[model samples]
Target chain A: MAKVKHHNIPLDQIIKPENIVFKRTKLFTDNVLSYCPGCGHGVAHRLILEVLEEMGIADKTIGIAPVGCSVLAYEFMDIDMQEAAHGRAPALATGIKRTNPDKFVFAYQGDGDLAAIGTAETIHTANRGENITVIFINNGIYGMTGGQMAPTTIYGMKTSTTPYGRDPKQMGHPLKITEIVAQLPGTCYVTRQAVHTPALVRKAKKAIRKAFEYQKQNKGLSFVEIVSNCNSGWKMTPVQAVKWLEENMLPYYPLGDLKDIGLD
Target chain B: MIVGAIVVDTERCKGCELCTQACPFGIISMSEDVNSKGYHYAYLADPYACTGCENCALVCPDTVITVYRMKVEEPSKAKN
Candidate 1:
């Protein structure tokens, strides 16, 4: 079989359920992912889909994707997904969760979409305890719009809008949106995770699964922030970007749970 | 005998080395050859050493790795 002529391995061999260790979840569509070569969005999307599949909630859940790199989330995720205007995913999710309280609802957003343009909606929705899960992808730049500085961009980071690196005097500090929401009483579970390494990816997936579990319990708003990477925007190889994230981003946005009402 | 296999969607791979770093067995490596997308891709360089841990697949942001492992039956105690 190894000597077979370059065609894909026998379908039966690949699809044997007993031998499979890891494969794509049915919640993911046939569509190939649209993210850059090593962007963390792909891992994050797959983890959410896998969680839905494991929980058997693919048919009873709705996802809201706002503008930013994640705007096309509906194309890749097979579950029912809706597009929200820039930064308005929380608002759209709020409505959906309110009307369909029994169904699981989630809003997937990027740093620019959630911490910047959608800050008001994000804060308010979580403050109100909307019974929805918010999956925030923070790469510290506006990836889809060409790596402009986002609210999460750390000081001294260079982005298209911050050619000389971000000057705290001019741009203020990088917003800790997760911390902000965690302080609010509406949120039930708040955690920050990453997907750059195998250990980190597993932790991130577990966090997402926990968020879904919290939402299913109707335990107010559950916020899970994934500190991801954008290799293209960062002008680094996938390997380099992970290293850079460890050196720079992790210090500022440490991984771990900020608040867990579940434990209370 | 081989106990595990990894399949990559070569055309979809962007040659990110996340999988390379994730494989504890050091089995994955980047190919010098370019895929149709004009990017280097990752490949399994040491199939025999693979434990089918699936860590590479978990860290791959491109969702390119599919892992399969043969089920190993436990060996019975040797006859006295």
Candidate 2:
């Protein structure tokens, strides 16, 4: 006997661009961000807003804002956002997405929030194949707590917690979250990109859109790690921080998609 | 007809070929010359035929292409 199979259509094909793009009434009319001029978080915020606007699901989306620099995301973003404990955004997102399956759910987390105190939550959320988008910003330091050391911190990098530079012998090596998460069977898409330059920023946006696309299709977890720069925390000018990220960090975490399950 | 120049930064070019494929006017083409990274870079063969749509620059993977439109002179203005 022959068996029947089913196919799923992509959301991009179903949703028209006019409906997805943000309307003037839907955008937040706020002043410029207080973040340093070159902070990647600000760019990330704009990209998320653009994605939400383009998807035309701002009203149906729930963003779980994690602790760190983005704690004040609610003030800037027009969408409904719930504050989650440090490193608990993923866990909160999991519950929100599972219960409200129809809504688009996402968690915005920083390196310290996702790789340190929330490692277990991050792993379990991805491992369980939660239908949610995880936007992980790896800036190599804890920006909110005044430049503290983070799991993604590079060797010889000095932070508030590592005043004498990060000693690999004691602090261990930097964590590659994308590589680790890509190994999980539940994860449908895993990518690492940066927003330091316009070219890179475009790629980051595409990766972000793809993650959300996977979530909309109920294709399980999608993790996108952005190599962000914390200019203020790094004690460097915004331009210098962007240059540093492009030269130093890019060599360590080269941008590109690590895995694509091709659910769409 | 006015002609335009299409500049490509070989350093940033990732050779995705999306720009070459997106050009509806078929003015842009990929060159056999490999960049430092051993990837074929994109170039324009027919500048006069460029419609200035900028679809090539918009779709370039590395954002290396820059399309500039040259102003066209009218017959009356040229005579003056």
Candidate 3:
């Protein structure tokens, strides 16, 4: 006699309802954002909020806002925030964490802030193994300052500073920060993520949470670089920005944990 | 046993209408009415058909919607 085969459903589906825990929190204020329709910063912001919520550390969290487009991150995040000078969020966060050892300190910076003017601060912060989380948003251009060329600007990509497109000969190559930070011994957890889609967003959140977890464990420096999209700066619609990020950015900045030292 | 109903934090909702469109079981419908924040909100007219796949929750740009699957126990054979 032939046997019938039955597919088994996931155990999670059969578990108790109370066992379900929110992966993140919803502490973000209900203000309508000023971001462009398809900008990935909004998604990145929500993911950070979720991570803070899941870790139950909103009250203990302190964020350092960068000078670029994301300078206003303090407005969205409900946690205590301090405004840093251009490319100085890492320095500010370093001081905050050093003084307040019990607080969870993080710096939210853009490509221009991380890869350019703030390069020394970011590198030294990671090198010193500061007990802080650095969330870097790489949109490849200076979104707030009118789409100027960022240090991470892709080759052949056009921006205000590179109207004819970024030429390697004159503009030099794009910088890969995750790889750079991964080389430092003081760095504990380093990962790159994107927010172009749901699956990717989920992965990004996991990385963000892991970064925070590292900080919670006092595991030195944790860095999460999000390959974001600047729809308004890139001159693309929201959908187009996502598509462009996938097509153009992912190839250069592949996603995943570049370094996971001391993580259990 | 009924578990919990899905709740939407309308303040974070962007009114993209993707949640309403992504509902596979036709249980979610966009409300003509807006929320306290004034953005259009998605409503669930038929909670029974919701499979709790979280498809709507996953697609929301604002992370506003949440699907809560209630635990339902089958009748105990010996007790019955």
Candidate 4:
């Protein structure tokens, strides 16, 4: 049988109240995602907004966008947002959460911003157990400023800066910042997840929601490390990148909950 | 069984094909035609097979796909 063509049909004529199953959340501005096609950042951004909308705290939430690929997150997220300097999102979130204890606070950061330049701020913030949530995107490279080796770039992984692949002898080892924070007494929840597949997307959303719920209960700092793909930075197509992430990235940065309240 | 349909925002689609990969029924495929962005967007190749599970919209980075599902009414249950 021949397939029906839908490009000629108007969207309104296709969508109706009785059959509508899913619609884009209103928390996201209509600004088309700026990230490269197939990049994980956009999905991560949607998951965060969906959580905010589900929790009924979109108006009461304040997001701190880090100086990385998501620097313009303030423009995309409909809720109130603040842009933080390179690696300073944690520090800013710390201050904001302290001042506005009643509001839900979160910092969205990339690996470079959280593991490289923001190491000091990140550690101290988690150590202090600031009543906030940190959504960390670990794509293992500096995507916005062009592909470069990041602290979380797995050993032997190739980035533009590490063309021949990362060398621990010259570059140093990959940093497990999420695990480091989980050991801190201040942090109440810490987990690692991905959004490349349908099952993982659902799990990632649940992790995001759980992190926010922890913040609402004032349970110290909740950290969610989303091990994601950077298709453009890695010089691979979106589909290829997702496959590479599963084959190469997953073994090193395995997914699952690292720490949770009463879960050890 | 429930029948599903989807509205793809051709202008917004990046042709990533994640939706095609996510469709459990293998009903979605890249279109032969290109949108304004010069990319071959995803389209419902076998719309009748769609179950409206929403996996396509869930993984779409651009948030361009809106899904719909319809439960066909049964004549036997119409009396009730």
Highest DockQ: which candidate?
4
**Residue A85 CA error for candidate 1 (Å)?**
0.4
Per-residue accuracy of model 3 over B1-80 as CA lDDT, tens digit each: 43333567766565655566456555667678887767667776665445455656755666666666644554353247
List clashing residue pairs in candidate 2. A20-A54
Binned by DockQ into CAPRI classes (incorrect, acceptable, medium, high), candidate 4 is acceptable
List, residue by residue over A1-264, the lDDT tens digit for candidate 2: 112111132223323333222222234435434454346776687677778888888889998888998887777778889999999999999899889999999999999899999999999999999999999989999998899999999888889999999999999999997799999998999999887654666788888888999999999999999998887788986556767887888888888989999965
What's model 1's lDDT at A135? 95
lDDT of each: 0.87, 0.76, 0.78, 0.89
lDDT of 1 by residue, A113-165 (tens): 99999999999999999999999999999999898999999989999999999
Query: Candidate 1 vs candidate 3: which has greater TM-score?
Result: 1
Question: TM-score per candidate, in order?
Answer: 0.92, 0.71, 0.79, 0.93
Off by over 4 Å in 1: A1-17, B71-80
Interface RMSD of 3: 8.9
lDDT of 4 by residue, A119-157 (tens): 999999999999999999999999999999999999899
Candidate 4, lDDT over the whole model: 0.89
Better of 1 and 4 by TM-score: 4
- Kindly report the docking quality category of candidate 3: incorrect
- What interface root-mean-square deviation (Å) does model 4 yield? 5.3
Residue A43 accuracy (lDDT) in model 3: 73
Better of 1 and 3 by DockQ: 1
Clashing pairs for model 1 are: none
Regions of model 3 farther than 4 Å from truth = A1-26, B1-50, B68-80
